[model samples]
Target chain A: DAGITQSPRYKITETGRQVTLMCHQTWSHSYMFWYRQDLGHGLRLIYYSAAADITDKGEVPDGYVVSRSKTENFPLTLESATRSQTSVYFCASRVGGSSYEQYFGPGTRLTVT
Target chain B: AQSVAQPEDQVNVAEGNPLTVKCTYSVSGNPYLFWYVQYPNRGLQFLLKYITGDNLVKGSYGFEAEFNKSQTSFHLKKPSALVSDSALYFCAVRDAGNAGNMLTFGGGTRLMVKP
Candidate 1:
């Protein structure tokens, strides 16, 4: 109930198509983050939002776009999905920043063909 | 740059024995270190953290970690391992002076406990 959630827990999209993954948190956390998890690379940040309308790029933000229209939502969009873009996406929320602990969502598994 | 290293890809421990998963970090200033656990097909869960104050921090599921600032290491340890404790453990650190809520995570270590 009062936890982070991601929509479409599993997704399969074709290459070059636009795909969006939704993330919502019930805690009204100020900071929301999107990360992609791969086999070799544990988890790489895609984008993060400090607050509503305040977004920042992370380590691997290319080809991805994110926006926080409200405190409870932070959605990630892939302009043109590729095979490399397919990975498990995780959404996390923190009341503050990294100085505080983060709570994560179940995660969305995406496969691009 | 800030980074975290989890040297071992996998760790094997027998039930009732002590267990340890090594982690080393590099940060600009005083580091905020954390350990998270993840079960198969699930999101990462908070385990323990060493922000300030104490060096020996105990966490959920009877797990504890010792922070060695001198060695830049914060290793997770459990006095007695359990079969249920097996999972993927990750060590992470935030970049110094930047409160971006961005954490650099290690590649993760798979812990397997044998009964």
Candidate 2:
């Protein structure tokens, strides 16, 4: 309950539809990150937020959008979902620093048909 | 540009035996290396990291990694393996020169520990 958590641990949506995955962390970490896990590609960062209202694109930011209105929450949105976007999404958080370790949420498995 | 490479796709070991998972990285400057484990249907769990100081860094669950700067490698190791350790392990790196602190993860290596 106190640790990070993600909503709709599993999701199914159609292509071209909009879907949003929610992530919340009780730690109130300054840095929040969104990553997608895919076979062969491993885990690629989609977006990251340094603090409230501060966000930046990661390695694989195409086809995805993210917002950090609150330090405790960072939500990722798909404007127009595609089959290629279907993958396991993970959210992580860490204190703002050079050597801080990141903590991850359970993850959301999204399938776009 | 920063990138990581996990040479082996999978590793198999017997319980109680020593285990090793190899990882290599390329970064623009000093590297911040890390190891994470992911179980079935689960998110990645932080294992260990090598920021500076000692070449050998010890972390959670009796896991440790040795950072070799010359070789640009950080291999995870455990003295004795357990069946519970069977999972997907990922190696990541961040370029110290970059201020964003973005991590680049390797293609992950699945460890199969047989009891």
Tell me the tens digit of each residue's lDDT in model 1 across A12-106: 99999999999999987889999999999999999998899999999999999998888999999999999999899999998874457788999
Candidate 1: pairs in clash: A98-B101
lDDT for A62 in candidate 1 is 97
TM-scores, in order shown? Answer: 0.97, 0.97
Candidate 2 whole-model C-alpha lDDT, 0 to 1: 0.93
Question: In candidate 1, residue B91 scores what lDDT?
Answer: 96
Question: Which digits, one per residue and each the tens of the lDDT, describe model 1 over residues B2-114?
Answer: 99999999999999999999999999888888999999999999998888888999999999999998999999999999999999999999766765567899999999999
Model 2 lDDT tens row, B2-105? 99999999999999999999999999899999999999988889999998999999999999999999999999999999999999999999898887768889
State how far residue B29 of model 2 sits from its true place (Å): 1.0
Report the Cα lDDT for residue B80, model 2. Answer: 100
